[model samples]
Target: MVLHVVIASVAALAGRSVPSMALPKKRERAAPVVSAASSAMQMQPAPINPDWIIAGEPVARMADHSKSADRAAYTALWDCTAGTFRWFFAWDETVHILEGEVHVTAEDGSVHMLRTGDVAYFKAGTWATWRVDTYVRKVAFLRRPFPAPIAFAYRLKNKLLPAKTPTL
Candidate 1:
């Protein structure tokens, strides 16, 4: 559910339209997949929109791990230097802090201090203010959801025709 939201949000943020829920015409077997250690993955600069910065210059970096076939979901490693900024969640995002810490203030005036090993979820279409004192790193899981009508149809179809497990 959250994954779908994230994907939708990401698509919006990227100026891309959300993909339809329809399956591809040709079904193909998926290949085995693996990712290198986070420490070994090269991080690329992912600059924050200048207008979103409130205080100090924050430097951000990111490394993508994997993306779903339909491009509706993905995981990535992200980090940032000390700074205060407004983060607009374009997608549903669940983040697991890996290093350092950050203070996040939601639009509702609630504040959360997320440290190493902490996990937090940010809903799509929301905004939060983040303050990173020194540095912070996290793994972000994101997903885009189907439209309401399409989601309902999918749910109804699943209930009517449940998939059967294949015999090994």
Candidate 2:
């Protein structure tokens, strides 16, 4: 409860203004990622590789979004062997390294090498690859999650069903 209060307060401050990257009107439709080549985004790359390290940014986001406030928050850590992460989806997360080192490739191809006692902030929307050498553990938040099995079901439904709008 204390954590929630602090996070919300910070979010109200850090996320107070509308970022150009803020969700668009009628946010039901997710936006596609813009390329790094865009003049504006490319102008100011991080001076240091991991400037965001230890920054508790994106303090609140999709990784924990839920219809029920009762269950709006969730957390997890990863120590997988995938070696490379192809991309990320609709989620804003906080990753606190418990052990090991990770090479984080930003959606823009910017890179950050993080190790123990380091923290990284991932916004609600960005695609990136995470390469872990040893094991990794980090916290995360999610909204409208589709676990592997459930995601598979959704794929099948889309494949089998023709497009249609149903009456409620």
Candidate 3:
């Protein structure tokens, strides 16, 4: 009778009616995946989750969901008919042609024509311009927010070259 009374009192005070769990919360389950966009949400440099989003051709910006890393990536839209204006961006990137055909011009004026299934890698500080003679797409993966002063210096060096540009 004494043990029963104590147990009942303890259960009532604890409000559990049963033993509590002592599992580790550090071993929690991973969070679910959430997409950055749809037809509804547009960004204004808005708060991003930093997962990733590449809607193929029309949208040019990459979306982030994590809000933690310097990793950036995007897929490019290529239109051979547009014959896009010559411009160069400073960064290393991986390019894989998804469809149609296009020409890429390196800083030295060298031109490489790519078709569906072709691939190319642009080194850090590699100067390039795109000439899409056909409508196509390319996937690009790039990393920024360098770690140290040396890394930043290197990225700056590649992006800002001396004016005596080379002729290919």
Candidate 4:
């Protein structure tokens, strides 16, 4: 059956045995870790490539908050002054606007006006034009995604052996 083949492939790729019909054992929860609040962190200047700028000078600042255990994901606070520029996404990023606004135009001509409290996602390998009339501040969650084949295998493994929920 297709299901059997999928399970076998996923298990092999994961280098572990997974019972086809059984859930995986729950992982023990680690101690809670806390980082400094965003408001308390100092932002340092992060320069934008001059060649990417299309208009007025835009000053930008950022402060890193945390990174995942695998170093594949991170969170940061960022803010930029008024300017127009082409922005490239080297990794998957989801931004939660905290102050001001920005008008983003996609390569396909789709325009998104993001303001305070708004959220937007930009995928890896994409570029967009950003126009900020005054300022924009946001919390950005970034991740480096797994490759296509590996991602497929991971999904299959999760489907075959669903993760167990830890009890409080």
Q: How does each model score on TM-score?
A: 0.74, 0.41, 0.43, 0.76
Model 2 lDDT tens row, 1-168: 654454455556554552656545663533243222212221222121233323322121112112333344444434433245444556656777656677888888899998888888876667666666655544444444444444455565577668789899
Each candidate: what lDDT?
A: 0.88, 0.51, 0.50, 0.88
> Which residue segments of model 2 deviate by more than 4 Å?
1-68, 141-168
What's the distance in Å from true for residue 152, model 2? 33
Q: Put down candidate 3 lDDT per residue, 18-99, tens digits, no spaces.
A: 3677866566453455443322333222211223221222223222333212124433322223344443355556666766
Residue pairs that clash (backbone atoms under 3 angstroms), model 4: none
Best by TM-score: 4
Model 2 TM: 0.41
> Where does the lowest 10-residue lDDT sum fall in candidate 1?
11-20
Q: Tell me the tens digit of each residue's lDDT in model 1 across 1-168.
A: 764675566546544444557777997664468577999888999999999999999999999898887678889999999999999998889999999999999999999999999999998889999999999999999988666656565676577667889999
Cα lDDT, model 3, residue 39: 27
lDDT score for residue 93 of model 1: 95
lDDT per residue as tens, model 4, 1-168: 776687566657665432355544875553368478778989999999999999999999999888876569889999999999999999999999999999999999999999999999999999999999999999999999776655787787787777999999
